[model samples]
Target: MDFSLQQIWEHTGLFARFIIFTLGFMSMSSLIVIAERMVVFRKTRSDSRNFASKMGAILAKGDLSTAANTNLGKDVGHLGRVINSGLTAYRISPNDKDVAVESVARALERQAQREVQSMKRGLGVLATVGSTAPFVGLLGTTMGIVNAFQEMAKSGAGGLATISAGIAEALITTAFGLLVAIPAVMAYNFLQGWVDARSVDISESSNEFLDVVARNLTGGETRSQQQAG
Candidate 1:
């Protein structure tokens, strides 16, 4: 018995159709997230690089005030925000070296956490779709097999023709599930890697900024103590 795609779709039972619809929805959602994240990640990377280059020269001159103010600008990214937090803390309590260092460290940590959280938005959905889509499809397959057996029982004829429709539905739904799941899993991995790389860059930049602040603060303290002596 030959069956066309249209014939198979028309014959697909309610449960199998529902599973296919669910898979379609998941795929669409994953695609949306992938597109949105790609744009955001690209812009963040570009902005961070620009911010780092501009601030690097300023920090070399021991200009904490300028560095702190740069973060408020529209062009700054995560690295700038982290650096701004620490610099703002230091500027507020320049003479209290211990307090300033502690404050800046805390600020950097907080900002890093916030940035990571922001980057992780929508990833949970992707992960859920990647992990559960196959199982959902499998459920459809199970339902299809049951339906095929039921049809065989009803017809009283033991032949492939009696069960072909159910089998086709089962295969179609399973294929659709894999189609949705494979791309979703690949996208999740790629986006996760991008997030990790961005995080590393932010961490390294924060550390460099902290080192510059520490040196300037320590030098100022040394000069003050020598003057007192």
Candidate 2:
């Protein structure tokens, strides 16, 4: 069959429309996931930046009361949650130096893990869409080609133009699928990296905070004993 590329582009077929619709849905889903991830990453990144500053101020000032005050808030990031947990532990057992630090560190670890997981939410869907979209598009194209050949079989001497519509639809769908998949895959991977980095930051910050708390309490003990003597 004789088929010109121009003729294929000009015509729409069943395969083309099906592929177009499928690709459209996939693209829309990917966009939604991207938007969600962007919001999460932005918030997490901001939190990580502020956390160190706030923590440094708390350690330098040696004011547990003010530190507690500073750490208290609903909008604070993962680091905030960890710090707060530690602070809470200290408040609960101010005398038991080991227990206070351990309790808070353990609790914060759990909370940090949870927050990291939350940030990663919906990424799996994006990955799935990206990985599978191309094959789906190819399937549509294959079906279109099959239909075109069927038509050629019946027509005996069918020209390319005769099946041009089907073939075009197939190819267009495949292109659309790839277009949707690539960005989704890229976004998913990028977001994953951001999540990993933030998780590390939270862990490190929490550990440093515990160290500061231990040092502060030890210094306080030494000074108190000397004063009493």
Candidate 3:
């Protein structure tokens, strides 16, 4: 009995076919998530670089008043969003006081968390597929072998040859499962590492912005005190 893919699929029972279909869907879903995450990360990294290069000096100088009124071109990435939130908070603040820095810090933190969470979207699907695909494949194989045994018993067949087709069909599901799972796990790990690295970058940048805000507020207060005296 030939046990090629076509032969196995053609002779596979409904349960086995369904398992194969499920693995296929999982593979496709992982691929889509991997592609989407890659694109998002690529765009975000580029935008963040551009934003940092162009806006770092202006933002560090605490020129929030001018920056708030200016159009910060589109797609400044996660860092841009966090910076803009801080700027907005600063603009609304009444004065260069402890209150202003505290408020801006809160805003930056909130936006940073939001950006990290947003970037993590669709990663759950990859994790789920990576972790569970093998079990799903094993389920199909188990059922396939059981069905093969049942058929053998009914036919009174007592040789490997009798169940070879059924065994092959069952094993292919496991192969398919592993084939689907390995890449998904690898992709998940790689993307997760990228996300972690970006998260750290965002956190460090937010802290730097906070330092700038504190210094700007303190400097302004000192200038006012001297002028008033």
Candidate 4:
């Protein structure tokens, strides 16, 4: 069997060709998701770094009022969005320290979850491709083998050599399936790891932000009482 991919492809039946095309589409979908997620993560990380640098000083000073309702000037990233949510909550709530602090805490928690979920967008597609591609290819191979046997029976031939070419063509889909699956699984794992790392970062930042908000609110109330006294 002097078989190249092109030769095998040319000889493949309609169903085998359809399976190949399906696998090809799956491969493309996974690649597109991986690339899109990579770009989004990179851009968002850059924006986060910039936001932290610009806002860190004010936040560290526990000047919640100063940082509240800040103008982002552009689409902000994860840290920016979470922090802004807390600040907006703080600013909008009434002057009760406990109530305001509680509001900010809740806002931070919700926004952090939202950011993590946003970061995780498109990962489902990667996971689906990784898990399903092999099965899809297997389906193609099974169908191909069944067809191959039918052909042999029709021709009244009985031997492995007689059906070798058909079997080889059928196995090609399995090979292609493996090829598509391996990279998708690897990419999914890699991107999932990145999301986990960012989740940790968000958790830490949210904690720190809550601490700052609580202290600032408490201090403001104490000062107001002292001045009144």
Tens-digit lDDT track for model 2 on 1-229? 3246566555657656667777889889889989977987788667756775766776777777578656445667767776787777777765766777677678778787888888888989898999999998898888878877888888887787777666766787688788989999899889889888888887887787777778877887898899999
TM-score for all models, in order of appearance: 0.95, 0.84, 0.96, 0.96
Clashes of each: 0, 7, 0, 0
Per-residue error for 212 in candidate 1, Å, reads 0.8
User: Residue by residue across 1-229, what tens digits does model 3's lDDT show?
Assistant: 6767888889999999999999999999999999999999999999999888877878756776676666668899988988888888988987848899899989999998999999999999999999999999999999999999999999997899888888998999999999999999999999889889999998899898888888878888899999999
For model 4, give the 10-residue run with minimal summed lDDT.
Answer: 68-77
The positional error of residue 66 in candidate 1, measured at the CA in angstroms, is 2.9
lDDT of 1 at 40: 88
Q: After superposition on all CA atoms, how large is the RMSD of candidate 2?
A: 3.1
On residues 1-229, what C-alpha lDDT tens digit does candidate 1 reach at each position? Answer: 4578788888888888899999999999999998999888888888888878888889889877777666448767877777777777877865788878777888888999999989999988899999999888999998999999998998888888788878888988888889998988999999999889889987887788788878888988999999999
Stretches > 4 Å off in candidate 3: 60-62
Q: What range of 10 consecutive residues in model 1 has the weakest lDDT sum?
A: 67-76
The residue-level lDDT of candidate 3 at 2 comes to: 75
